[model samples]
Target: MWQFFHKLGSPKWFYGIATRFMPWLLASGLLLLVAGIVWGLAFAPKDYLQGNSYRIIFIHVPAAFLAQSIYIMMAFSAVVTLVWRMKLADVFVKAVAPVGLVFTFLSLFTGAVWGKPTWGTWWVWDARLTSMLILLFLYGGVIALDRAINDEKSAARAVAVLVLVGVVNIPIIKYSVDWWNTLHQPATFKLTEKPSMAVEMWVPLVLAILGLYLLFGWLACLRMKTEILIREQRTRWVRDLVLAGGK
Candidate 1:
């Protein structure tokens, strides 16, 4: 386990693994996403309450899930960066920040779009919504901090500390509906209990959620590979790879 963990810290090893798996990830993720969206939009029974507008959850739930999940993943990487001093960990933090930001923004945008008909408005200050907004800011802060610092190492350390601090918002985002009277509904899916939605309705959502997670993995690998090349440009391995490609 330690050996595998140590190997994961190697940029070259990760790049090679990612290269081999990237195509598979992309293919499977796309397949699942398309399947989920088509099935949900075309075949699944409409909500008796919200009607077709609830179909938007097919996209919104997955994007929202990815937004929060990516942050949690980043927080783990931040810990690894601070504790293990792994350059690859810092590379991951840098590479995935933009992706997280994009997903966070997507979630917020989609939520607003979904809200207009359901909530009778485009925006609200509800706890879940507010915390998610803060989450978006955290992603922006990480990206801004990374760009602001000239020194890579110093910037990584700063970002890691900031990530650890912002992690406190995650649980609040998770439990906001329960902790306070809020406009937001309870989680659409939960691990500890069966979903209240029908199997037909929720299966597509499950596919969507899984597909989005795989898609995030693929995107992270792509970004991390690019980051590794940039960071490792001075190394002999990188030089050899470049020279071979030139040949």
Candidate 2:
């Protein structure tokens, strides 16, 4: 296990592995996403109360889940980079930021859309909503910090430290609904209890979440490969690979 983890520290090896994995990940992600959309939008039974408005969960829940998960992933990568000085970890951090930001924005937008019909308002200062907005800013801040520094290593270290510090907000975001009386609904999916939703409703939601995770994985690998190529352009292996491709 330790050896496998250490091996992933190598940018060249990671780039090669990611190249091989990209096609399968991309295909699987697209399949799952399309299936989820079809099931959620058309086949799933309407909510007894919310009616068609509940269909927004197909987008809203998955994006919200990814928004938080990506930050945790970023923080974990930061820890790895700080503790082990792994360069590939730095790439992962940079690769994931923009994706996380986009997902966070999607979550917020879908939440607002879902809100108008259910909550009777499009916006609110609720704890869950506010924390999610802050998460988007956090992602943006990390991306900006990465671009601000002249030295890549210095920038990576700086953003790693910031990410570690900002990780405190993750738990706050997770428990916000439980801690406060908020307009936002409590968690829909829980591991310990049987899902409150019917099979038709829950299945599509689960599929959507899995699809988004796979899609994020595909994008992160692609972005990391791009970062590797850019940073390793002067290397003999990269040079040879590029020249060979021209043949």
- The sequence of per-residue lDDT tens digits that candidate 1 reaches over residues 1-247 is 9999999999888888898999999999999999999999999998999999999999999998888988998999999999999999999989998998998899999999999999999999999999999999999999999999999899999999999999999999999999999898898879889999999999999998888888888999999989989889999888987888821
lDDT per residue for candidate 2 within 74-171, as digits (tens), equals 99999999899998999999998999999999999999999999999999998999998899899999999999998998999999999998888899
Q: Which candidate is the best by lDDT?
A: 1
Q: Backbone clashes in each candidate structure, one number apiece? A: 0, 0
Given candidate 2, what's the lDDT at residue 184? 92
Clashes of 2: 0
lDDT of 1: 0.92
Best by TM-score: 1
What is the lDDT of every predicted structure here?
0.92, 0.91
TM-score attained by model 2: 0.97
